[model samples]
Target: MDLLPSAHVDAYPREHLPPRDQWPVLSCDLPSLAYPDRLNCGAELLAGGAPDAPCLRMPGGEVWSYDDLRAAADRIAHVLVDDLGVVPGNRVLLRGPTTPWLVACWFAVMKAGAVAVTVLAAHRAQELATICGIAAVGHALCDIRSVDDLAKAEVPGLRIATYGGEASDDLLRSAAAKPDRFEAVATSADDVALIAFTSGTTGRPKGCMHFHRDVLAIADTFSAHVLRPRADDVFAGSPPLGFTFGLGGLVVFPLRAGASTLLLEQAGPEQLARAVAAHRVSVLFTAPTAYRSMLQLPGGHDLSSLRRCVSAGENLPAATWRAWHEATGLRIINGIGATEMLHIFISAADDAIRPGTTGVAVPGYEARVVDPLTITELPDGEPGLLAVRGPTGCRYLADDRQRDYVRDGWNLTGDTYVREPDGYFRYVARADDMIISAGYNIAGPEVEEALLRHPDVREAAVIGVPDESRGQVVRAFVVLRDGLPQDGRTGTAEALRAFVKEEIAGYKCPREIRFLPGLPRTPTGKLQRFRLRDLE
Candidate 1:
């Protein structure tokens, strides 16, 4: 891969990209993915809609026109360069719930030619600090309600700016004084636009660097060809913009199609149903858990407005798919995407879908089930590792784990799958110790690390257990220190759960904890996690 001339003044992101030879095979066979050398995705996405067309809508009946969003993004871009001293390639951290203003901030970062590092609002101080440290973040744009956690992160010399607040120094207040028109930076298509972080089974997060062109490649391949979104569609979802699944469904896909989206800050099963009916949302993106829960809602919901439903972040069971189609005449599109690949690569929609399979590779992508050791393609009906390559592939930020993810021009997603004779990829199991509970990825070792921080815990092991609601739930087996009260086990379990919550995100906390005299270990002193699963 040849390099393109960059417009970035600060070159940290580019300097940290993995060696070009280690990158997965990238393809752009589709006509829509042939982007120009000097492209700004922020300006491109805002180009199609009419000036007065609705671009963003809130649950409270507030709507922002295309012109309104463009102007706000332009003003914020000016504020980034002039007020915050931001230059191209500087990593700017964005921490906020899903809202119109958060989307505007993302566009502003792109327009200013800076790399956006979007972390979830549920991330705590330790998680935020780890991400900021890895990305070398110097500035943060945080919502007023979510500023406290970012403020507690130990990133020295970090410049923090708050938004959606009445403070005099708020980001929106500063933008109010700036002009509503600014020229977007003429960045190369290969310039880093965002660095999304994903947890590894090793209990550390890896930064996935995606180029400016990768953002639009997802829309061209999956959204354009498969989802077939129309300009009149109204998108709504429960994913926060920090996750790529949410970012594409809520922001990129709709904006690229010149459609409108309803942003919800707190979307539970009931809240999602009400908003869909009230706003007439036609397209929805959420996990299978949400769909299952919505089906059990009291008196049911008026989902007649919905035409398309997308399920990702975790596997969609055949039972859930059948139940949803039986209730509402809409077929749920199931996709499997990684933070490294940016968005979905293998998915099916409409008549092409199979109940239990994850469909064939989307247009412009290739997938195969390969033997993990030799990378040889496996025969039909044989379970092996799932490997894929496409226009957008894994590019870790200078991590040695790059070799583990990308091998022989293919990205090996740590999933075990079996390919049917007809080419449909069937769902199997994860080959790693990652726990997918209610659409969130929880690393077992990471949760175990949090549990070990307690003085009472002598040893601990975490594993994912099957659940009816969530696909899987985190369960922990702990060996306490000497002389602990054995009769008060129930109270100790509650106390341990509360202790773990303070150290990490509440969602990663173990739902069930069982006391053990000793964790299963080998003679070589290595923990045997397979024994833990057997105990479950």
Candidate 2:
């Protein structure tokens, strides 16, 4: 197994320590060789060497090796380029969860030298229409489940291909007769590989353009330093292929290490644990929330094969980390990754973790805490906005919001954090969305964490609202367990509110609480605080 050592200096053992000086600088200008440059890194690794190695495992229980993956991609590349007449740099839309077909289509689009426009697999017809309209996509390859939704959108010139089995029954027969082997298409480093949708909490999602170099940057840096993979390891995760976090976790990292990845149809906790045992998945990349629920499963599932479990999408709480570690011996790797930055900025190794902190910055990136309003750097242990600058910088798709997000080469994620003296970062909250009432600054996450501790509360969201008395008191919107009664005595919404008061502080106690069927979440399972605020 490849030992990807700690990027965290203080956390690193004396034997595994990286050079103190000249270490923070990134190794830019990645290898350039091949247009539609293959967007998914898994197949690109096959072209680089390791041809026959296993690469993808679908939920239906089929394994496709790297040679198989590349062959499949090339065959489709021929169809997409020759039969469909797709041009280099043209946008070819791709949608669905992590299935072998989704993985194949992603690379096939890139191998054809077209930009892979990825949309959330969970997106409905209206969402698909809006994205296709914005990107002017003329072609799409989606799963059978999402094909109906994509078809519902009356996108002119839009051609769609289904990926439940074959492109169609006729194509399946032809592919079976023909011997499968294909050469990769040459793509330029500067050529666009992917246009991923950013989770627009407030409004419409924006397409973030990333280059082939940007796609490989994570493999060279974070993957090399953090998730050092082995040939025997099998990768799997929940984030849909549309999100960069999922793309990197399920495809890029393992392929860079010449390993296999589990491309599941469903990655919910139960399915994920089952996939782990079935495929012998060793490395997991998912959210902290999912890990917490996995612990609640009857007795604990066999995760013994798992060597690493990465948590992202939101801050990984220490409490959640403790619960997961106690249930399964596997330590959860925590990090903070945004769509724009390409991959994780800060991450911790299983052995070198401080539960609450988001590890140290990756070798290629420089991170610091800054005043949200002033944009000035803050001292260690002081709470401020987290600012980062690195090789993989934020490049939006001609959006005016770029000016607000990127200033002086620093990409400002609207998140609050504190830099520990030892270089780890502790997440505070989202900068703008924090709740403040009666001269007290309260992070919504703090209260939500306290609420999730209640057994009856399945989910909770905290938001500040206009109040006549307290001037924007903390209000919590909660979702009770399905079996639990909605009645006041049984569901315990009021009791949970009181519990939060005791767990946190009297001032931070939710002034009002309401029970709902479920909390509104993004396709990635991130709580939509903007929508929650609207409910108030």
Candidate 3:
């Protein structure tokens, strides 16, 4: 097809449920599948491909080539197996943003035949301890700065792995110095590869166990139909590598497509824009909040290099899409994926996209709105709970909610959506996260997306709070941009509220805007609505 250099990265080398050929199908379902299920991952990169392509380009233009990445992975692989006493099926708790070291640690874990449980770098010790306890993580690969906090966490007998900057890591260097030749351990398709934790605005957290097949499944679904990538392209983004969103962006998607990845250690909308301008990153994966942030930045950031953008972790409203197109002539491909689904299960090409709708189901998955209680699919164009399923499935580790989630073969993501007559899926709200005030059923995200449309608002989080008078009232926690309007008395806050009322239904508008420095967020780019509720 003669695509761009960075766009040629591999996806699912082979599609399973749909049975694809061009895609590389990785399966641990064999005698040859390596233990720790290593071969099922970037170990293939060891077999020779894109050797000189940039794997990771950081602040100093310190880019690591695919060859360098593989060698580094090999060293870490040896350390994992020979030093840390890691074996097949053990989970390695990894916490960090996307960087060459993070990438190396990921492949090295898988290369050593171990499953990687990615903990959002933003997770506090309590969250970390909870994940380790749930996933049975015995070893941790953490950033040096955060190792002390992690050490204090309740991961009994937890082995520690530390790295120094990008190149100055003795721990990783010792591992990376090993012979660049090591065979991947045998593993299987159904074997868990990652325990991704996601929170419902209310609960503690649930660990979504994804199989090796699920790793390729997301690409099988989204690549051909949505944000397709090619070799020679460089994938980079603000979503932390710990989240599946970033895992797919900085590693899986690019590796699956035979492309390199650029990992940003410190990522925010501003930092991402500067990095994008400097690196000419081709495919960008982030949230709508970051997109809006980039638009407010001064013009001429040289974003001419961006070709494809994918938005998830939150609903992508119409205004954000327009703002992106106006800024870069690129439409942000909006996708809605749950940690349970591994990655974006519903998405569409920007050209084929419908602005507010999350888009149609991916190539290998089925999406339908259903009555949550009845467990039956709803008629077309009807709004109901969104239940989905695919060949690559989700199994919660030791959670009783498993029965509640997967009913009669359908993975009921706790979300409500309306399926358009034309097969598109529109975001409604999380079934349990919906806010009911008096007679109005308010979707927090709907109101939040509306608030983000305002120029002065940097980010907004909407949550319903208890109110005896009108039932539950919608409250918004807003972070103003660099140059917010002055006049606290009746100016900035009042203007934002007015703007929200104009953008959305008056009933759905936030009753009050509480200016804050920043909205609470998880590492993967999901705004923590739970925190918004706590602010009350």
Candidate 4:
């Protein structure tokens, strides 16, 4: 209940932490939720575990044990401190596919007492620059294939190092010469551990600052109480590690439970099913869209190994849940979570799962439905904004938007929901411009800003339109700059889309672009996204 003093003196992350008053009130009432003031999550996750305990299993049949992971992380941490001159509380950016090495790099940053800034591998040069600049990242451990984009980000004085490459300059090679064992930094529970970015409606990324304790809290609460994963459970999912959903489901939860994760660098529906069958994955974490697609997979795919399936990212439709149960006789565990909160805070496991609703709050957390305008608690069955306060809550780093996310000790998750008398929360529509497609959160303004970068586009408005397969796809209504030939309409649209893909991540690019004479706007020029949705 009290703040813990950090051990690191540099504390660059502490300097940028939002003012104390703006922080969401964190509560840990459950006995299982207890955490120490002086803690290092990496040490807790990897140290003192059985040497032969399986920690990670790659799709290629390669497996790493708890001891192996710790040794690898220790080597990388030595490289960070001795070779890269990294100090405690420094922000280290990680950009790579979801591989065992990337997970090692993640723990390595925390082991060295540095804050991990995980960036999605799909991000382009511009998006990477914005994130690095906002976090003031000074060092990056990047995948060799991503070197070009990292260079294009153009952050001054940014020390670049390579990982997962066979080159002599790769982090793996440099780390091999280091000792096998190193002491994990003694970071306080309240010290910043990682900065995960979520897209803002205003076209900027908001870095959600999480503490070292918050990481373990989710594992103890959600993964422990809800999913109830055992040490032998093998976790696998489609979400990129950059997203908290994947970081928790694929890495933190498994590591905390002493379970192994079958890392799928590029897991689509087919790949997911195959991975599950091949690796005998016990727990599956993926979005509802993937669930539907996996159901459509041709016969003879043995998913019998899957005992528990968790769906999040986008709202889980009751139909998808029923379909999964019908196909596999295994109920899908549906939960809702945000990057700010780390992972699923409200989820039901096994028989507690109620179809069509995001189940009761996981132990150690509290949730309520509140009127969006007044922030007053709404009666059961009345849909309004969802507010939650628990061990893990929103803590935006040095951003004034912290005031918008956390108010009156509660984090206002920008989601419309209804709480039933039975305490099950049902999802409604999002209260913002965020579009959850497949499993990625794409902000409409961020995409519009990317489209605006094109020379031929004067104005652009991006909105999420319903799609059967992807949940929601980015659709753009563009106002082409005048004086264009009438026959160039098709070419211009395609060109604008390509230009946007070049500017931002490909997934954020508008899948379908329509030329509009003018966009619907108020007298003050405020965009009416409702009208755009109506056009769909």
Candidate 3 similarity to native, TM-score: 0.87
**What would the per-residue lDDT of candidate 4 be over residues 1-536, giving only the tens digit for each residue?**
45678876577788888888888888889886677778999899885347899888987788999999999999999999999999998899999888888988998999899999998776779899989988989999988877789899899889999977788978999989999898999999989999999844356889999999998999989988999888889999988888898899988898888788899887877899999888899999987657766876667489999998998876666666776898899999999899889999888988888887889988999999998778899999887889999999998888888988898888998888889998898876577766899998776756775665565665677888889999999989887655654333677778888888788799888888888777774321235678888885
Query: What value of lDDT does candidate 2 attain over all alpha carbons?
Result: 0.73
TM-score for all predictions?
0.83, 0.87, 0.87, 0.82
Q: Which stretches of candidate 3 lie over 4 Å from their true place?
A: 1-39, 45-48, 165-169, 199-201, 449-458, 479-482, 486-488, 491-504
Model 2 weakest 10-residue run by lDDT: 5-14
How big is the positional error of residue 219 in model 1, measured in Å on the Cα after superposition? 0.2
| Ranking of all candidate structures by their lDDT, best first | 1, 4, 2, 3
**Model 1 off-target regions past 4 Å?**
200-202, 433-536
RMSD (CA, Å), candidate 2 to true, equals 8.3
Q: Residue-wise lDDT of candidate 3 within 456-526, one digit each (tens)?
A: 76677778888898788888787877766433445777877888888778988877777787778766567
User: All models: lDDT?
Assistant: 0.88, 0.73, 0.73, 0.84
Collision pairs in model 4 = none
Clashes of each: 0, 8, 33, 0
Best by lDDT: 1
Candidate 2 lDDT at 524 equals: 58
lDDT of 2 by residue, 7-87 (tens): 211221112212222112233533331223224443465564377767787777778877887777777776776666777
Q: Candidate 4 — what's its lDDT? A: 0.84
lDDT score of residue 233 within candidate 1: 97
Tens digits of per-residue lDDT, candidate 1, 444-473, equal 655776776686776677889999999999
Candidates 1 and 4: which is better by TM-score? 1
